[model samples]
Structures are given as C-alpha cells and as structure tokens.
Target: MRVFVAGATGVIGSRLVPLLLSTGHDVIGLARSQDAGAGLERLGADVVHADALDHAAMRHAVRVAAPDAVVHLLTAIPARIDPRRLSRDFAQTNRLRTQGTINLVDAAAQTGAKRVITLGSASVYEPNGPDPATEDVPFWHRPPKEFIPVLDALRELEALTAEAGGLVLRVGHLYGPGTIYARNGSFLHQVQSRNVPIVGQGTGTFSFTHIDDAARAIVAALETTADGALNVVDDEPAQVGEWLPVLADLLDVPPPVHIPVQMARSAFGSWGVAFMTELRGADNTNAKRVLDWSPKYPSWRQGFEAELAHPGSP
Candidate 1:
C-alpha cells in the first residue's frame, strides 16, 4: 500500500510514519517545513511539502504522491492551553480541521485514493452523556460556550470524512513521549505547580490513548474495510478524581486540591470547569472489534508509569 500522511512530523505522525513503514507500506508524508520534510526523509518516507489549507498546493502534492490511501492527522494545538481562550486559541486548528480537511478529501478524490482516514476527538461528544460514550451518541448539544467553535470544527471534520466514505477515529487524550502528559510537558508542569485543581466532585471521566497505540490503530484502519467512526481509546475510563491523584503521585507531586464548581469556573473558565466536572469518557469496543486493535497500555496507570520510567521513549 502507498500511504500519504499530512501532519507527517506531528506528535502522532512521527510515531505513525515508522509503524506504517514497518508494516511494509510505502509512505509519502506532507511536511510543511524543510526541517519536517528532512525528518520524514530520515524516517524512510518520501517527503512532499504543502500547506494543508492551501487547496492548490495540497491537491498537487497528493496527485504527485498518488497514494492508495491518505491519512489526515493534522492539528496545531499548542503545548499549553488556556482554558479561558479556548476558541481563540483553537482558531487555526479549527481551520485545519475544516478547510484543511476539505482540501485533502478533495485531493484524495481527484487522485482516486481508495482510503481516507482522519483524526477526530472523544471530547467532542456531549459531556453529559453516558459514562462511556459509544459511536452512536450524538455530539455535544450544549457544549461550553468557549468550546463551540472547536466542537463545530470537529463535527464538520467527521461529517466530511463520513461523506467521503472515510473513517474518523475519535481518539482519546493522547499521552506519550512528546505529548502533554510527558515529563517535560505542560500538563506535568501544571501539576507540579499545583495549577490543575479538581472541581466539585471531579466527576468528569477521561479515556486516554498512548501515542504508539494510536499509531497502531491508524495502521489497522489502513488495512481494514471499516468506515464511519470508532473511539480509539484504551481499556480504562477514569474520572478526573481518579486519574489526577494517581498522576500526581507518579510524578511525586502533591495531589491536586479540590475546589467548588463556582471557584473553578471563576479560576479556570467554563470549559475548564466542564472538563473537570461534566466531560464523559469514550468506549473503544467498536474500535477493538472493527480495527482488531487493543491498546498496549490498557490503563492510564500503566501508561503513566511507563512514560515516567522511560522519559524520552515512544
């Protein structure tokens, strides 16, 4: 199989390119910068340079690669996120998810690409829904005000992928060497500084994905005929109250402090409060069955430990 990947040097893509190559797939990666292109070349992948949002450039890149499958893992999320300015911070990423997706899908169709796979988010589901959300659950009907645009972009991305008979893998919070959950990552820094406090009850649950596991799922998706959406999360779904303390303990930091919902909203903003109190976890049953994939670190507990033990490993 010949595979073309956008966001080829990103957190997931860096890991994904190696997996794709090891699986005997000929890979061509789109790198937006010279350094990124050089990195892709070092990974034994053919490199193409193009801005995903530039329709002409992207179309030309894909046509040149003429891949059998196209995988879109493009995103521009910052290392440290400001909960108060969620929409503003995510504006460029929203465009990537929307227009970037449109350009890629159009390019794939033009070049007769047989498969299209795009990344989606577990967080886009209604935060008040069932504990472990399945593929059938509707997206957030009333998401936090600040997250409206982010959610809208995700919805559009998924709808577009589905329209193209592609698969949208709704992955959970990705944690690995270079992700936010890493030792030198923003989340760890916040925890060490006692900044990420628990809101009332801390009921919001999270389903996490190891970067390697996510990369493997993408490889599985490439080989399978499954279409539509799948929640590519690990086995365990833990609440903020459950995971935060454990993460703190693992990092040898003080456990997160608890605060009232109102205090949290005032301190961290509405989306942050919803994230700590109302967000629901996603289920991976469908992904497991459809993609024949299972996460190596079945729980965040194991993943956290492994990441800490091997600080810079993927």
Candidate 2:
C-alpha cells in the first residue's frame, strides 16, 4: 500500500513512518520544514512540502504522491507545546480538524485513495463523565468547556470524513518519549522538578497511549479498512492521584503536593484545571475487535516508564 502521512515528523508520525516502511508500504509524508522532512527521509519516506492549511498545495502534493491510503496526522500541538495556550491555540487547531480534514479527505478522494485515517482526541469528552467512553457513548457537547468547540469541530470533521469513508480515531491523551508531554522531561519534567502540583483529591480518571501503539492502531485500522470513530487507548484507565506519585517515584521526585481544584483553577485557569481536576476515559474494545489491535503498553504508567528510559526523554 502507498500511504501519505501529514505531520509525518510529529510524535506519532515519527513512529508511524518507520512502521509503514517496515510493513512494505510506500510512504509519502507531508513536511512543513526541511528539518521535519529530514526525519521522514531518514525513515525512508518520500517527503512532500506542504502545510495542512494550504488546500491547493496539499491537493497537488497528494496527487503527486498518489497514495492508496492517506493518513492525516497533522496537528498544531508540537512536542513542546505550552499547556496554557491550549484553549487559545486549539481554536485554530479546531479549524485544522474541520477544514484541514475536509481538504485532506477531498484530496484523497480526488487521488483515488482507498482509505483515510485521521487522528481524533478523547479530551473532547466531559470531565468526570463516563468510566470508559465507547464509540457508541454519547459525546456531550457542553462538557469540557475549554475543548467543547474543538469537539464540535471533530464532529464536523467526522461528518466530512464519513462522506468519503475516512476513519476517525478518538484517541486518549498521548504521552511518550518523543511527545511534548515527555520531551525535555515535559510534564514529567514538572513532576521530576516538583513543578506539576497536585489539585483536589487528584482522583480524576483518565487514559493514555504510547505513540508507537497509536501508530500501530492507525496502521491496523487502515489495513483492515475500518471506518468511523474508534477509541485508541490502553487496556486500563488510570487516576491522577495514583499515577502522579507513581510517576514521581519513577523520576525519583517527591510526591506532588495537593491543592484544591478551586485554587488550581484560579492558578492554571479552567483549561488546565479541567484535565487535572475533572476526568474522561475511553474504552479500547472496538479497536481490538475491529482493528485487531492491542496496545504495547497496557496503561499510562507502563508506557511512561518505558518512554522515560528512551533517549529522547529527559
């Protein structure tokens, strides 16, 4: 299969490129910079220089690549993205999800692409909603105030992707060695350096996945021609309270000091506070059954420990 990957140098993209190459699939990755292209080149991928927002350029790039399967890995969040700007930057990110997705799907359709697989997020779900949200679970538009509009945009993006038989992957929070959350110690840095303080009871449940595992799921779905929304998460959902101190221990740092949610909200604002204080998790049954997938890491703790040992992490 010939695969075209947008954001081919990103956290998941970096891992994905090599996986596709090893699978004997020809890959053409979209690179926004020469440095980004370099990684793809080294990974044995043909590189296409084009931004996701530029539809005309993207159209040409896709046409030239003529991929049998188009994988949309494009996202605004980088390995070092600021947590404070999530709400502000996510509006444009939402545009990328809605409009950029439309562009990618349309371009794929024009190029006679067989399948389209795009990344989605579990953050759109409400804080403290369900234990494990399924593909059949109802997504509350009013929940997770900061990410609400973004979820709405995903709804829009999925509607468009559905028109062209593209698959929408609603994955949990991505934390791995190459990701912003892990790079340069990242959230792990804050924890190791005693920077990420605990809030309230810190019992809010959440989910996570390894970048490689995410790539595997995407590849599996593409290979099987699986369509619609699937939750690409781990075997178990973990709570902040339990995971934090464990993570701290792993980094040889002190256990985090707890602060009230109200106080933390006043400090980190609603966007940060919601994820830290409130929680949403996803189920992986559909992915296992349909995509024939299984996560290499069963939970965040296991994944992070391995990633922390990796060279890229601090």
On a 0 to 100 scale, what is the lDDT of residue 230 in model 1? 98
Candidate 1: lDDT over CA atoms?
A: 0.92
Worst 10 residues of 2 by lDDT: 77-86
Residue-wise C-alpha lDDT for candidate 1, range 277-301, written one tens digit per residue: 8888999999999998999999988
lDDT of each: 0.92, 0.80
Single out the weakest 10-residue window by summed lDDT for candidate 1: 122-131
Model 2 C-alpha lDDT per residue in residues 1-314, reported as the tens digit of each score:
99999878877888888888999999999988999888788878899898788889889999999999998877775434444566566777787888898889989999999999988876556556546777776666455456667668888888887888888888888877566557464666677678677788876677887888899998898778777889999988877888888878877778999988888887777767767766767888988999889999887777777766564542
Residue pairs with backbone overlap in model 1: none
TM-score of 1: 0.98
Quote the lDDT for 55 in model 1.
99
